[model samples]
Target chain A: MTEDTKKLLYVMTNGPENPDKTYAPIYTAALSAAMEIDTSMYFLMHAAELLKKGVAETVALKKGGSLKQFINMALENGVKFYVCEESLRDLCNIEASDVIEGVRVVGTSTLADLALDADSVISF
Target chain B: MRTECSREWDTEGELMAIINGCEIPDELHYYLEGSQMTWIRLDGENATIGLTDPAQTRAGRILHVRIKAAGTSREKGKPVATIESGKWAGPVHFPVAGTITRVNEQLELRPVLINDDPYGEGWIAQIKVTNQAEVAGLLKADQARTRFNEIIARDNVKCIRCQK
Candidate 1:
């Protein structure tokens, strides 16, 4: 892949329940936006839990700043969020109806394909 | 103040080691300062290791630290640890072959400790070196700086934190 097309970002880890671990996806998405790249956040493993609409809000209420707000900002700025179907089933134990709006449930094969296709694949 | 470009060696005073352009605080001693990379040599038959200042700056805030357990034998160039920052997670190869004796438990509490104090509290692992001869293959402070500059130039790495 060409350097220009290498903008996709993959995040396979869970969002922070603690304050210290909060910067990973936050700064990463911000950096991608700064670079003006076509950013994609792939939620897999324990990471799929972040896509639950109320979950971010709940964490925000506890932490003071809205994680949902940050996610919304990313979404409004054109960050594509994808939830892995297999991970959602196995790890999250959730059905399609349980997820937040605007999330696309995709197979594990798609993740591999995207990783291979993207010019750069960064996992947090 | 102007930075000196001259390559002059200070052969008079006591040897103060530096790593990747950053001063290795007097409390710490250099174990393996190979090229642009440097690993902290911990005390005892087992030694703890981690990235140096220049490395942490280039990589950004560390997010995750994946390590192997005690008793596992590892080879040089083999990934002894895997660290993830904001954008990347990759293997950190060792300079010497050894068996892992201990891993820093502090990393589980705060992985950013690696970025916070790489030379101090953020040490990665303790290894019992199987071959002490590999220690001779490493570099020192002055050489490390030159090699680091070369690497940044070769990779075309723009320093986002510090403007070149």
Candidate 2:
């Protein structure tokens, strides 16, 4: 990445329960990465539930394609995936091993740092 | 009609094959990544690149395009542009390493040019070659025809050009 390469952070708080709200953030993050921005998606609160291996595979919008497809698109474009550790362990009752691949589990402090360092932050 | 220039490598006036209604021009080289198709035309030390007819058809109607500016250097397999269409959105990868010399500015106004004339007016970028060897292995017309035919059948694609 160049010095001028912008950093973008997308925070998703919705999960499988809100399938309508799930796709846009990951899709936008993928597009941002394709634009050569250093883009990342952070799944906080219930959002971490979608990261569970089988959950995303079954989640899809009415139009078509599962949530895993968008997740793969984001990962393929070099977008970083992060999940809130507390949400994973306490809220979702899932271990780090239960989530899909290519995700980093991090503490609340990391999200704070990411929000501070990011050039732009969007929440969903 | 756009007039053609006479060059040994130019495929204009050649009887391009229509497999599954997709035009595969003779002599133009291609790069296929999964189902995505990109083509490269070598001109001395420079190369012109764009999506193939089947790729544009598969993408449906393009809505937006963002190309890297001229003078930007990109490695082979890196994106030269990001295109969004009704059905799909992603990067258009560079077939060979080079510094971009030009981008199709017309796309900003008429992104559907990608659907209307993917091989001609919709050409994406011109590159000044930094490594000639990387251009050597791209699939030529006959080779690409075989592959595109398989993909067309497998994906059940029937190419349709948008009316101007």
Candidate 3:
């Protein structure tokens, strides 16, 4: 929360369909937050599906852990979760009520603002 | 014993409790509330801090550790170090508010030392306590053993030390 605190934005484009790619963003985001960095994950395109209720719960990585576990960890570590409003409505067919409790339904403009403000922008 | 450090401790000491193969040395003070599994060993006004044995086991093999520089002042519940292991990543919160006096720099090159000797070489930091009362507020070894016993059963954790 300090002026010098670094901001990191993770742009997630993959979803439950790509279970392997889903965990890294959340895992690293949680770690970054633990490091006292201002960390956020912006779920866009297929990645927005991960914010849908019951989606992360059903997706388990090949390595024998559930996506829900990492998501919860990230949430507990203060990693901000954001779901693209456009992607959720148009591409994912997810209503605001269908999204998980912790995620914020934000617009593309918010993502642009976050990216511009961030010290690093990583895409998954 | 898994390592020289553990072997040196009096394994049969009356203060030590072996719960599910994890040693809880009652001689040290513990911060077992929530998932903050840290211990404080007081030496005058300076307190030595480290992750508990069960903590290292749960985290699996520690891969990286980044501790705050010495002389950094921190409040209670703030992290003195951030640890990343094969299975987990999180902050190692200090029980007492103080200024950092020392950090285990050896952990940078040999992070697995935490898994090998959690009570010894795995120690994270030392702090010159700002509040001596906070140091006393930490759980004693006996209380920590009772609590950790329940936690180990609930979490189904079996303490396993890595051969280093």
Per-candidate clash tally: 0, 0, 1
- For each candidate, the alpha-carbon lDDT, in order, equals 0.61, 0.83, 0.83
TM-score: model 3 vs. ground truth = 0.87
Lowest lDDT 10-residue stretch of candidate 3 chain B: B4-13
Error of 3 at A98 (Å): 3.3
For residues B48-154, what per-residue lDDT tens digits would candidate 1 score against the true structure? 67776656555556667777778878677665676655343345666678898889989877887776677778788888877777756655555555665655444
Please give, for residues A1-124, the per-residue lDDT of candidate 3 as tens digits.
Answer: 6799999999999988899888878889989988989999999999999989889988988755578867877887789999899999999898989998889999989999999999999988
Residue B138 CA error for candidate 2 (Å)? 2.3
Q: In model 1, state the lDDT of residue B46.
A: 59
How high a TM-score does candidate 1 get? 0.45
RMSD per model, one decimal: 15.3, 7.6, 5.8
The sequence of per-residue lDDT tens digits that candidate 3 reaches over residues B1-164 is 45422121122234433366888886799997666889889888999899888888777778899999999988888888988863477888879899999999899999888888888988889899998878768888888888897776666666778887
Regions of candidate 1 where Cα sits further than 4 Å from its true position: A1-124, B1-21, B24-36, B42-44, B152-164
lDDT of 2 by residue, B42-75 (tens): 8988999999888887666788999999999988
Colliding pairs, model 3: B26-B141
Task: State the fraction of real interface contacts model 2 keeps.
Answer: 0.32
